[model samples]
Target: MTTSAPPNPSGEDESPAAGTSTTAATSTTRRTTTVTSKVPTVTAAPTSPTTPPATQVTTSTSAAPATEIPDAPGPLSPAARLEEVGTATVDGDELVVVAPSDTARADARQGLAALEIWLNGGDPGSTWTTFAATDPTSDGWRWAAVNRRTGAVVYIR
Candidate 1:
């Protein structure tokens, strides 16, 4: 008597070919083993002989514009911008400081103190000396502290 084998779960043929492994066993018991793979199988669609392949185009949202940015303005120059305005006047080589009101004078004094602090490293010591009336020496930096808002000037040597 002959017995037939069972079908595979995936419906694919797993049986040995005809005339292959034709050795006769001593026992009637049959042990069937099926192996499954974890890898997946991919299949491409059937294309016609005269049909052309398709093209793909991609765009990026993070791309920036190619326009040029404007240049920023630099710090103001005291000599060029800070001229005699309002009550401040120029007396020969010196700047004669004359404010319109007491408030203007106070502001001018604050500006003068700021300029002095800037020149003397926050502490104006004996390094800051007044120029002589008769013979003024050109040794250190001579600056005219001008208030940009009120246009008040104070000359320092």
Candidate 2:
């Protein structure tokens, strides 16, 4: 299903089979040039081994604007940070960690958001278990939470 252009004598591709024709364009103009150059050599007299190159030092007097350092963010309370879960919402007293949408794209920021939510006010470690698993039907990645004490699945998406 492929064809190559015919070999050309001038080294420029002029093959019509290659989707290009250069015959008229190539004959429009011609150029010729000649170049000349001269180089001179000189010998230097040897100096004493103790002689060193002169050194020059310079300093600028212009004052530069002072850069202000930004204040660091204060520490976040447990309720301010999200757990490794994607997103979280408060439903009554329970903290629900929602999985990130694959179509929307998942990344480290989402994971950090989840972690922050978990740290903030999500379920305590003793109440729920968060684990990653592959869905058997679609073979896609998923995160699920199970209530340890109740043996109930919280969310899977």
Estimate TM-scores for all models. Answer: 0.23, 0.22
State each model's C-alpha RMSD to the native.
16.4, 27.1
Best by TM-score: 1
Report the error of model 2 at residue 51, Å.
99
User: Model 1, range 104-145, lDDT digits (tens) per residue?
Assistant: 454555545544454544543332222212322332224444
Candidate 2, residue 95: lDDT: 36
1-157, model 2: which lDDT tens digit per residue? 3334445545665533455444444233333334556777777988768966598677879877553322211222233323334344434334344332221123333433443455455644444445445442342224444443333332323
What's the lDDT for residue 70 in model 1?
Answer: 18
- Give the per-residue Cα lDDT of candidate 1 at 88: 24
Best by lDDT: 1
**Decoy 2 TM-score against native:** 0.22
lDDT of 1 at 16: 64
Q: After superposition, how far is residue 108 of candidate 1 from its true place, in Å?
A: 2.1
